[model samples]
Target chain A: MVLSLTLLFVLSSGADGRVMHIKSLFASPLSEPRVGAQRTINLSRGTKVSVVTTQDPWVRIRFAAGTGWVLNAVLSDSPPGKTSSLLDSGADVSLNARKRVSGFTSAAAARGLREGADDFSGSKFRPDFESVRNMEGGYVNPDDGYAYILNGRTR
Target chain B: MKQHVAAAFFVLTALLPVAGAQSGAPALSRARAHQGVISTEEDHGDLTAEIRFGRALAARILGQYKLSADDKTGGYVSRVGAGLVAMSGRPEIRFHFGVIESNEINAYACPGGYVFITKGALSLMSGEAQLAGVISHEIAHINRKHVVRALKIHGGGGSFASGIAAMIGGTSDSSRVILGSLMDRGMDLLFKDGLSIADEFDSDADAQENMVAAGYSPAEYRRYLQKISDAGPGKTTSILSKTHPPLAGRIERLKQREGRLGENARN
Candidate 1:
């Protein structure tokens, strides 16, 4: 059938030892496939590795460091450009770096919503920072997320 | 000959996952599956802006509805949501999932990564797939940056020097006023205006890909929507019905999408 031929063509297009690069915005943890597996390493964005195998949502990859599993979503066939320094800098950038990054905040300042708008008062809805913080504090650890997937996966 | 090659390429792209599964190697990034509709790129606006704006909006939503104290249910949803988030193509941002104590069968996704599902909606889900389906839908909205793009809340410094204090030198009283007004408009969008129909359809399409890639049943998502539709237009379903397109229409579009992808293409 035509579909059969197309499938064959597609499969043949890709070869063994296919290379992929990390496409996640931040560093991604390469860990064992199983639930509660220890992280093998944290591969930064754009790190290239060879594909070893895959499970749904997890791909086993062979990097220079070692072979381990990574989320399939984090792998891209094409290498990504340099990650955005502004977004990736986090809270640790030096004072000079902050000056370079001040454009973003300056724009917000122009709009009257400066960087620290916490003292924002006179709102009809009493902003409940405490409750929001509590909710955010209960982040689901990646290990727990993997366990949930393992337990819930029917296939 | 050219037409034939094009057709083959289309089929190959569609069936890449099937080949990947058989070869024990990922065929292509699942992110590509969504690239047609929603680009995997996340350059909507400033990262700090999205988070701060989302947090502020979340606080207001919490102001309206108290969070459920059921740790078991909350933890379960959080775990499932987190797993999906890991593969959501927007892993850079931390996501928070909360269950609010509301009888209304609705869910809300804030601009950044805050997602809330009402207890009433929780009761309607029959199984984990159904829950995943719903959560995936909300995740789609967040990943797509629907609210953020619509609100136009952009540009903020990174988490440098306690972002607020760093801006104290530039603070104007008008900034507080502008932020408050922005919140008011945001509330209206959540409560009355609702996102565009195009956005809803896009989210549903993205959710289908998310569910299929995550090894959950995409059909179950349609089924969940059916369940909501069957519940009829009552108080519990009022807000959902008001905000979203008719469930019947959404289901039909999903069917069309799945048909295009072909059943075998889904995991």
Candidate 2:
């Protein structure tokens, strides 16, 4: 009885510490919250960190390497590389099957959820989805983005 | 008696976190909430619905304004936007950036992750940072789900029919009518009523944060807004003036944020 109670206590208290993951393609942890501060290491996306505190746009976090500051926008509650596949596969399954399986998809048909916005296509003007797709297709490589940042081209 | 003690201890320990979180977690809670990551099955359905809605909205916008044929310009804008997206905390929805042929100094963001800047808006930007500021603001709107919330476009499974039902608090049988009505209203929201001033200000603040995170100057956003404000009653500025709050107010807020952050930096 004591052991079971202790396990329950541990599980319940665990929610107190929230883990945030790096959302940016690559984030360099700074020694301070300010921009132009010294950076010791680059953390890749989805790297988990325990947040210590926040100063609005910046968050101080503790990771395997050490404690450092990263921008708040560079963190998310969800793990990276999980959402897209979930959405895609979920879309492929028929609405009826999904309804039988889960409440999430049970009302999908009633709600008009589909893989893409193709169902909403009866606008007076022909929707230029082709162009939107073309735009989506042309992703800027992450390496190019890093190069852009390194060069301070935007600065 | 010992078992009773253990049970009581377990309950107290479990409740402690809840009490502590209630006392000291507003900021963290707000951040987690704003991230809006799809964590549950319901969120998954809502997000899928949001994407579909956004795609249709993008199509409508594209129909109204032709995409700029200049690949180089489009590519440059895409690259800058990509950097902002990296820092946006919304990796689930792949953002697509494009340049439209309109000469108006305005940018539009659809619910999903579609962003477009007008050629005139592009011309107004002095450099890539300024462009980042602009794109970041639009990205902020999408990231924050401003349109989605305003339209009440989440829940009720996933179709426009059900979304419409949710919005109107009634049922609709015709999918076509439902979708068309929703699209028209969304268009009106973008082109007519505009998002609430609070939403605009929130995006401005978020834009600054995103800019700084992406290694760009938030001041550039201030400068761009100032430039547009100074340009005055021209064709290029007309749409923006209607769709956004006064530039002076936005600039003042940005300056205040800068001052606060600067103080933090000093401390």
Candidate 3:
């Protein structure tokens, strides 16, 4: 019965998402956590689990026995047949900006926030730069983008 | 027999995912679950898939940076990163470390014992311990399986699934273009906006513990954070937030943990 259950879990866990191999089990995402301890769930290498939630660097997953958290850094979203080189190159920031502005405008409208007033125009809050240049022996950029915060926007 | 059944039931109950799925279940809830199940001798086969995938991606990424395998600085980074991993108590897993030639102050870890530190980030470290803190924190991300969990929640089969799908539909050269686009998007999410406050705190706590494990003062982790904070706003371009919880909050947390270390510690 134990073997059958384990097999069931193994199969079920991999159905929805890629099976993530556990690298290390350090501290849990709970209060008063400790490190370098052994765990039953162990988060062993080759252990398969279904991703339940994703937010930033943390992911929530369900194993056969239960659900737990995983760091997004440790797992690959290995879309099949993708070239590794293409993924390594930097993303198109200009395209991202267009999408972001549209999203921002929609969100602002939903919240009744004003738009197109140049309220949130500035690069201090955003780290968009053409290239990171080493400036005059200091971390200053002669063409460093200006910093701007939209009125009523939290910086 | 009854006792055995009862014990099994207890273990199962402990292993069960937290119920109710409350949005505000205290940040430490996940850590508690991790602590409840960890034990030596447990099977970790699930981690292998991530390691294999990570190795392939790292190889490709490093190759693009033109970082030679024989580079001394790369070797130094690996040594320091591996040193922190050694403190994790599970020395069976060999950790691979590399320095990515980028001007972004970021460090990340992928499943399967692979960790990378960027030159931009390396240039900012004032001491070996601080670097160790960064490496240890990335290690903690691996240990915690943060990436896998995130993908499952956002959309199963990992983000790499889409990239792979793109590749399968095209030739090698075309695939490379697709892959690069996918990778760039991935980097933006991972480095620029994917990290959460909870994730940051977990890494912070793990770095502190790993520092102690490696025979360094955990307070050194605190000191590095203070230095970064002192560098003032905008000096460090966090892909996450313009200004994270001010240095004051981090200091307070460190003070709370300091009691565990005993007397004569300077504040």
Candidate 4:
């Protein structure tokens, strides 16, 4: 147990110093805070650079031979050991699916508990077998199909 | 009556060349002969005469445009434009440069030393050499007398369509009718006409010659052209396309003439 716990702590610390990759070029014609003409930089197709600092929409990065600031919108977290193409394509899909499933389960449990309870006494007690089964099997919810369809993860 | 007097004065100026040959006015005779050809008829002339008239006319038209003659901006423009002009064989003609207030990206020259460039044109230029490229082209127009000769050929009517109408002598009313038809066509000619392509090529050639003469790299013209081209088509057709040469063809011509122009840094 101690060995396992130590390994987990090391792993958690390792994840803290993650490096962010710059995905876009942002330049303003003037050095002013606003009213400057902004343009995108597209140096290469798969170029990678790390962020040194960020302030809202602007981020400064160190690129080959120099450092410059780019827009924050042009960047995304670089996934571990994966090429940018795969990370970009799969990251949003998996994250959205997981969030939808967890949200649905919690919502259904709360609705079932509320509807089955008659008073404070009943509410404090465990739900009946039918109520528990109905909630778990998706019978307590008439909108499960609709939710799945809307979430886009049903297929 | 005033117009008649002006015409008589012009004629006397033309005849003075022949009448003064036996007198001690040989230099005046030569000056009159040069002026006669420029005044009596309009055609591109030898280098020295074109340079003289280009400097003179540029000054007059630039004054008419009400451009500021303040030494600050005017001095900067003349310094840059003259450096480029000096490369075109160091002609004796003075160079006059002016900045216009309009937001349009345009630069053009009138006869005799006038070059007017808009602030909008300056905003678009990325560097000093790009400005040189544009000014050199306008100087070529003065040297070629493209506008004045076209005006004389077309009877002082505004544009190409009017020139065509005047050539046929359809009617005084016909000139008005031609002017009406030109409202839309004129925009096309002014904005996308092919003559500009030829002018652009000539200017590019002249600019290359001037750049080499000034001891700057001629390749900068190519680089500057690429930047303007990359800025994408302007809001209207590029003044370059409308009043100058096709970019791709001019670039290719510059490339061909690259070796003959004096050597300088490539970048």
Candidate 5:
């Protein structure tokens, strides 16, 4: 019982945060957050990593993409654009069987999320830029954010 | 014609905010003095309107570059952004963070709390502090409402979409078209002319302060600026290329204060 409790507390306390999918790069979860400490490896959008521990606001994830420690604010509990994928001609957009990821077929479509949530074609423009706006609003509370930052940016 | 010119002058001056207003961060004392006769109770109304206007502009930027298809990347940015905002002077505003897929090498801030960074810009970054620096600058812009000030036409002090239209209502037909097109003017700032050089410098100073406040190294911010400066001219149409050329002075300013940022640089 004690072992299980310890494991549960460990998992919950240093809870895992997944790498968010977007078009930016992340610092190597540095050996330390400093000038010489900058790691060459970085995590790009779509790679999933796990957290080993957290020191305050900094989340410590041991991963190969070079990001060893990152701010807790950098990780997302959920993936953002899961439905967005590159589909080949004649293949259904919904089909997940294909492993290959490609760029958008249409420039207009790729400009934003669909006009409506269900419209995956992504070609039409809606007056309401919901997807864009939502991405901006996805902020962690300051108190929570500071706690994450307290975690050192290190390996 | 002179009457028209006089009216135009009035409108232009209204648009060209004074020291406090032009900076977008009017001193509290100045604001209070300006509003000496007015009730503080009405301040809330102005804030509400400001937030509403910011939201509309953010939506328009979304129209420019949709969110990246990779959700985690968006999430990652938000996390970094949230950390910065948490440490900022204005933590109450719910700031939004997004990475546009365009290779433009740019970042933009909309009033209210909307910020967008491009993949090209991210590709150029070396560390989290650099990212925070770039973002802190944008957040400063947002916090200061610089772009919002630029977009706004005073006098009537109403909806951005309609304020300019209202200001130039009695003018010639061509001017009316120009007056109505706020989006065109806003785009010009993002894609062409960029903010007034003064605004950029002010934001740079503010960004460094915010980065330090958030426990990130301002030197990283300086390093990022150096990298961008070293890259020189990029795509002919690149936003950074066109607007940020004045960065030599900016670089000098950062270098002058590099020692202040120090090793830890944070409080």
Candidate 6:
């Protein structure tokens, strides 16, 4: 009963709207209020958790695994796919804007980035103008990257 | 008596989210559920603004550097980078990793998960670890929102998501006029490498953390720094060196962090 009341008291302390996830495996969680306490559970990177409360470095969170205390360092409010500007940027700024903004280059327009940067800088051409034209994109599978790094080679 | 009353009221408030969750609604916080009279949603949308602006800069940067002729290089860097970003706090943001075909040994990140490394930097990289170091460093910047925070760009105030979204992709004159002012400041940051010293240090430190988390050695980053520093009179060092603190200072800071991280890992 006392434990439940303590939980209640802590929960009401404010830290709402934040739903962060584990950003680093180095995030060691403490069972007690103080940090570096006897490590009870080790959270893997990318584990999602809802922050119930925060106290400096420690945050009390609720997860499917159960409620626990973790460091604020491990948490990030960045929910996946939230940055999809095609969707997330709500319907407010379209009042007087044009339908097509050519400045918004496609991801495939690698050289477009160069040109935009050059134009912004008052037309000082980049050293490798030819190379920029040669830039291209293809079907990139992220899994290939995972295999390379896990194999212990970066390039 | 007042303490009990307040406690009871808070307890009722706290359970509101739990009840809402049960009814199949997104968990509502006390701040959202009970605004009394004022809405705090304005400050909330700032994160959205920061991301949209970062993407705008990311596109501008791509337009400046152009993608490399080697399509395979982007795939390679993307893989290494994705691994580290998976370990970042904001893995939720889709990261578009590309390689720039420049001879300068440099790597930069625009907001909203757009990271780029010049061909020069990639050519000098001996192995995946060094690549991870550079990519992770840039990822660290995006994760920390260093550039956006430096510019003091806030969300809303009539420049809501539509405005930001339109500004990023729309070609309208109004969008350019309004967003031009904001993007112009951001562009200056991009060309001059004008991130504050503190943000650079923070990115370096955080990059190390991301590297280690992804199972690469942070020492490799220090080694990369040493390599460039020793080269001294190279094209790679020209612009990147100016925007950042001295190489010696950065290495020292990393060395200290290495010790702390080691201790933290052990305990």
TM-score of 1: 0.65
Give the chain A TM-score for each candidate.
0.41, 0.58, 0.29, 0.30, 0.36, 0.41
Q: What is the TM-score of each candidate against the true structure?
A: 0.65, 0.75, 0.47, 0.41, 0.56, 0.62
Best by TM-score: 2
Model 5 chain B weakest 10-residue run by lDDT: B29-38
Ranked candidates, highest DockQ first: 2, 1, 6, 5, 3, 4
True contacts kept of 4: 0.00
**What stretches of model 1 exceed 4 Å from their correct place?**
A1-122, B1-45, B156-163, B166-172, B264-267
Off by over 4 Å in 3: A1-155, B1-45, B56-70, B89-93, B153-186, B240-248, B264-267
Residue range A104-141, candidate 6, lDDT tens digits:
23331432222233211221222332232222122122
Residue A85, candidate 3: Cα error in Å is 21
lDDT for predicted candidate 1 compared with the true structure: 0.63
**lDDT by candidate, in order shown:** 0.63, 0.69, 0.44, 0.41, 0.53, 0.55
- Model 3 per-residue lDDT tens digits across residues B1-267: 322221221122212132211122235443332321212222222232343334444444454443423456664555556555533412333455666667656676654455677777778777766777788878776666554343221111223333223223232443233334333433333554454456556667666656654545667678776766676656345642431334567667766654543322223
Candidate 2 displacement at residue B130 in angstroms = 0.5
Error of 4 at B192 (Å): 7.8
Model 4 TM-score, 2 decimals? 0.41
Instruction: Enumerate the candidates' DockQ scores in order.
Output: 0.18, 0.24, 0.02, 0.00, 0.09, 0.14
Q: What residue runs in model 2 are displaced by over 4 Å at the alpha carbon? A: A1-17, A81-118, A121-126, A141-143, A151-155, B1-36, B158-173, B263-267
Checking candidate 2 for backbone clashes, the offending pairs are A111-B158, A111-B159, A112-B158, A112-B159, A113-B158, A113-B159
Error of 6 at B152 (Å): 2.8
lDDT of 1 at A55: 60
**TM-score leaderboard ranking:** 2, 1, 6, 5, 3, 4
lDDT by residue (A1-155, candidate 3, tens digit) is: 99999879767664345444343333232111122222334444335566655543345566767765544433333211111211112322223434534554455445443332211121112211111101000111101111111110233
Best by DockQ: 2
